[model samples]
Target chain A: MKLTTTKRLERLNERYANGDISRRSFLTLTAAAAAATGLSMPWMGRALAAVSEVRFDGWGGVVQEAIDKYAFQPYTAKSKVKVVQGTFGDENEIITKIKTSKPGDFQIVHSSGVNYYIKYVNGGFNSEINEANIPNMANVLTAMIEPFRKITPKLSAVPYDYGTTGIAYNNKVISPEEAKEKGANLLTDTKYAGKIGGYADMTTRVWYAALQTKQDPNSIQDMDAVWAKVRETRDLAKKFWSSGAELMDLLSRNEIVVTDAWSGRVAALQQQGQPIGYLDPAGSYAWMEDMLVLKGSPMAECEELINFMLDPATSIAVAEGQNYPPSLDPTKVKLTDKIAALPAFDPTGSMKSLTFADPLYWAKNEDAWTKQWDRVSKGA
Target chain B: MTKGWKLYDQRLAWILVAPVLLLLILLLLLPIAMMTVYTFFTFVTAGVESAVLTFDNWKEFLTDSYYHGFLWKTVRVGAITAVICAILGYFPAYFIWATTFRHKWLLLLLLIVPFWISFTIRTFSWIHILGEQGLINVVLIRLGVISEPLPMLYTEGAVIMGLLHFLLPYMILNVYVSLESIDRTLIAAARSMGCTSAQAFREVTLPLSMPGLGAGLLLCFVLAAGSYVTPQLLGGSRDALFGNLIYDTIMGQLNWPMGATLSIVLFVLLGAAAAAYSRYMGLSQIMKGLSA
Candidate 1:
């Protein structure tokens, strides 16, 4: 029920447009409101200072390009506030940069969801967001918001989009039938030795390994079997791509014929007429991405920006362009055909069909597993 | 008045040197001291650490064989690269020194051309040349060579090749400066005193250029050993150098304390190499080559 300053101002404007007050009264009230807010707090001067630009860091690829084209550009045009952007191939790389930087140096992040949310929370880099500012949050799937809410009841981030990390194969070498039948096992197939690739990430590697070993990723047992399966895939892989762009490069150049690839990136490749076939095998790793406003950000402006991004038209356009489904509840807001057809799109809006990594379960094992996986990927 | 002027000259000399000395302390020594302190800090979780001083990070580094293996491999790779650079770079340095061709500076200009392009782009160019559907494979398959595309990229060899590409010019420049400084009369004297061309070259030219070659070797070795990008781009996971390990520890693992420990190890090892070079070959020769 806490209203953002923007929402309060918006209501004032609405009343004014409806002739609820005289011109002098409206002007007097506006000035009084501004003075009260600005002079009320010692630190409010910096916080309420006109934010001309919002600094945003994100994954630099087609995904970010879509966000820029569909959301950021339009918002900037409407609001006249520029969005300064930076990119990181890996989330942890940006985390390190943020650690070395001062509080307000970085503002918003296109963060990988709850799994990374824990890291931010632990690092004390999280900021409480006033949800009433983002009215569009009403349309976002409750299932997507729950995970983040579970970590911090007062959410610091809003789930924006979701996708699957599934098996992408070159259709020229692998038939759709073969890909469907083999599923996650295709990554470890000896036939594709020296032509195989995988994501060089702990969660993705361990998740696939869990699937291959017939263990649930959320409650993985038989750690040895999981490690063995991971090693099996590692020994056969030609390379372990670390970024989405690198994944596309390897696949397009045929440096790798089979690999675990992001569904959105594979969809992009298909759109470009690449002979790529994508499938979300049973227990494929699913993840959600969020717009995380970090500590010491321009809160009202960032909340307003998040609100703008979540507008159904903008969200849907970004989803279609990025080939990821919007976190907008499909049952609430109508979606385009392109979004429904996009990989990992769930019509029911329950999100139960996709097997997202349990934030608590994964966060608990991240440090140990990540260290072990790093060594394993390096021929340990 | 003359004595006072002499005293003023000494103060002027100190004033001229103070800025550089202060810069070195601030930029180099202070950061190293901070990292050394961080090496003792406890790593609680990824991206979270405590200032509670402990010897655990250093203890782990010293006790672990995994770190040692990577460090040794990095040194070995660096040594191999230096030796190869010395062999491949000598003739080019000798060519520029011995050439009577007009526009000698143009040859040196060719060496400087690669710097105009981005180092990352130069490394990425190898992908098109070495990938499966790349130029090498297409041409070889067309000409009825072995059917399979040679697995040339992302190997240790590719990494070494990338390093060589980057560091070769340094080697050539260093050796060239050494060769240029050689007195032509010394070689002429040896040649005139019943020595053949090859013998004169070995006795006079090669020995005189040793300081430059030695300097180049040390420079190439340090740069190659400390390389992070080339191996990350061109080498397979197993082919990662100590620098990559440090990167993984700090950035990937978010274990900055251990990363700091690894960094200090590399710094100390490289510093030792420089000290050893200074002991055997006067460090001033390296200075002369670099200045020229």
Candidate 2:
């Protein structure tokens, strides 16, 4: 029996050497052999126990602060899992890190909703979440959960926070009525050219254009027209901003009377006593930040962290502190009367009116948009 | 007759050059080689898939009119900025070098003062000086210069101004070195031959300083070509140059291969310019002129 087994093993090894067996199967066989040889011993367990660390990569600012206070500290205290934090500029940086660096370099990453959809869902960089392990996920609102479910049926991401793209105007320079009027007629009106500003991001710009034009953000398949409109708008635009700070600078300096801005950024500006007011006149595009477990992560602790973040109190604190709408059940947490009144976090609504950003659309049409924008901007 | 002396000199030369040569190969040549190879491949959207050998990225750049325009614009802007710097820098450099010892150090110190602050901070400071309600506009309006604020910050004029501000010193320093190295006797000889002061300066000083001017122009051009922050902050959306395009490709679009291709293109153009200058005007002579 031993001789027959040896011969069979030798034949299998020959097949593996000849590239018949895949690396996955080879790894499985190796693991089985290690188990058979008694190598899954006490030392391995002790070593793993000693190195109980989880790295969380995310964007900095209020979101990071909320994570530190509500999730990172509490989770570390309860589970003794050391949380190491790294900050990234945007999704591209995170993608670059994942592609170039070692696996599990960032076990968990906080990503924008569209980025999660494109990179995690469409690009297959994320693993399916085991919902049972994330008990606190039950607290997330149905409306917020619905979009992710519809878009990525695989449940690859856990929704974290949300914000809207809207017009932020300097109240001192532009009246509320003027701002609203401009917001209402932004797409069709060529009169306000050279005074308006917007983000440099193609996805955000496209969504804004669609909303202003009253086109269905999801249904409008042809982007060439959209690119043309955006290019026209760019010519009219005084500047294209890359960051929140730049927008604020433009507003403060009165270089721009009104501009498209993120809600959190506008809120931060308001807190700083800038005479800025944000309004979502034509129904703003909503982006849900998601915490996705990278593939090949140390899953157990990552799941624990996600569950911890999903808790109602934690979610509420993150939302209020970060100036972003939390994905958790709204009824369970107390919100400022002003925050509660915001359309995004309306507790009584069965469905929130939101234009979901599609990354696939952006990816497919980016080249065309870039070329058009280049032409328009250069006055070619 | 002197084998030991010859061996000693050879060893000394090798010892002196080895460290710098190794550093150059490691830091510059290796990265350029990798970038050259990467420019030919297409980066897969998914991380799981490996890059394949292809000419699609290069082909796209070659065929695309937008990128071609960007390339030409970059060269034009660089050339314009270099010329402006050369013109503006000549007088300051000559003035500083021509002055006596007492004023020379003070003038030199004044030239170097801007380098004390960070580049980003300096670039941002321009906004305060040139924005719609900024210092320049406000003062001008107060002085009844114009009824409305001038379009200053996000314009090509602002980009050129920022480039000039940043590169002016480099030109001055280079030209100064060249001016300082001229044989005082050459000027005396020209004057003794009955030439006017202006004529002697035009003939002798200017010709002797051509190498320095060329070197400074080349440096200014290359720096202006690769500059990102000043142009993005100061120029209009359409005014974004080649560097900005590379940034957009890499960071905005997540297309590394395209970014690599754009970078290689920039590198080749800049490298060719440098090589041509070095071939026509000796590199050592240029350096000597700069240091003069």
Candidate 3:
């Protein structure tokens, strides 16, 4: 079909906007055409040289700082590719960007495990990595990489960091031993009823409840029993929390004697001399943040960036700086004893203790669970 | 000559309203229409493809007893909050309107000062004030009022308290306008006619302020019904509201069709309530009350 001038211009605009053709790449294409038309210049060749720039989207603040210090600056220095930073408040926002924005807007995104599997893969928003370009993928521990491979054999995501969901409590009233002994039931116990709180996230809470009841976390059909148990426990709970600050405040005021808390926050509080302690029950939920390439990204640049981040030394730096466990082989890198002793980096015992959450299960049961959660929350 | 002036006046009225009408159609009406259309479609999976049309989402919502419970709870909370706001706001607004003092503006500013800070920060501050280790517990323990911290932060009461903090100003502002517009001479005439102070207030001021009270109540109700943050941060697991459900469906679940369905339902319910209110009390009265 013959295209009109306006249609040709529109196609060019679309290509440029989608980053299918960069400004330099577009100019190069035009210059080559001009050369064929006998209108070439030496200055045009210099301007047409490809400019290397990579954009990485991740959670902002200190996490971005870690990325800049360890990954961005080093990668840029080595490859001469400038790294642009994009920020997202949460996993949902990242997924939304991937779904709605033009594909090449983000070359790499830091996302939670559930989001990577459910949104990126299921939605067809991410492309499988070209394994050859990502040499460091071979360096990632088999156990760490196996989880992503099993979910999607083509490997759309690379593991970055892993953390477990566990209980945090005011040590003054509830002893660490007592919290350990009671396990997940501590939330439902009458003694601490109305004094207990936890994170408001359904996936974590449902998994915790299921694990407490000796049910499979990955099984969607089992969630009803879990929800019922959560409802019973929630009846005793003083509140369900949405943020670390709120959890800290609740712990401080003695409004909550116990709560489900992130390990990092619990550790920070313990360091501050607040009588706070964390417990990993036999079967708690664990999460890993992953990096995935958007489907239409510049595959070469994206693969290079992922490979750079997966380097043992780079991953180690990120782990140490962010206080989260790197998914790469820990033994490959040298570390100070203090940094080595960090809970996230040395998260051996807790890793086995956790029942890894299944994003598929959540995708299936989310509607019913959310509606029921709202009903329960409103005291209906 | 007068006919030309009348024609100009009519044209000026249309000119004034045209922009707002166009804006409302583009921003509000168009989105609502799209949302209604999408609600019929079924999302295959979270963030996956959606089909053209189906009744599955609406059917699921209607058939489920759980959703009905959520609906009832939303209305219950909205009604209770509105009532409380109206009662609490009426006195303060009336006082502000009746008083003639240099400090009135200062008092008004003090009432509105909370609006300057972020809602999330303010909600989080309550945790420090109410937690076991928080200020209240520490102060109470130090004063020997209690040995242990009282559980306060994550209860239904905390959610209501937070909602009150947010909705109270709207209530007061609405009622104050109506109260201020009332003529002082009418009140003086009532008093001069030997009507007792309480009698004059009940007969004259109270009747005149009904329109404002009704408007303030409706505003508070609508806002409270749609609130997600206060309940999410303050209320326990069973405290998630209709707004929270919408948030989870759209963001957490990635079930846009269901979220859209819930939103449309919420809007229709709200529209019906507003229509009912207008039937009992003219919409014009509410507008006047709000302006006052």
Which one is best on lDDT? 1
Q: Which residue runs of candidate 1 sit more than 4 Å off their true CA positions?
A: A1-48, B1-3, B7-10
C-alpha local distance difference test of each model: 0.90, 0.74, 0.74
Residues A260-290, model 3: lDDT tens digits: 8776556657767888878878766677778
Ten contiguous residues with the weakest lDDT in model 1 chain B: B1-10
Which residue pairs of candidate 2 clash?
A194-A236, B177-B292
Badly placed stretches (over 4 Å) of model 3 are A1-65, A72-90, A100-107, A150-154, A169-187, A216-225, A244-257, A270-274, A295-304, A331-340, A344-380, B1-15, B102-104, B280-292
Segments of candidate 2 deviating more than 4 angstroms: A1-57, A61-89, A121-133, A146-156, A178-184, A187-191, A271-273, A295-301, A331-338, A348-350, A358-380, B1-16, B43-50, B285-292
Could you give candidate 3's fraction of true interface contacts? 0.62
TM-score of chain A of each: 0.89, 0.79, 0.77
CA displacement after TM-score superposition, residue A61 of candidate 2 (Å): 4.3
DockQ of each: 0.74, 0.44, 0.44
C-alpha lDDT of residue A53 in model 3:
81
Candidate 2: Cα lDDT at A28: 62
lDDT of 2 by residue, B47-111 (tens): 32247889988999999888898999899999999999999999999888777778678888888
Model 2, TM vs. native: 0.85
Model 1 interface CAPRI class: medium
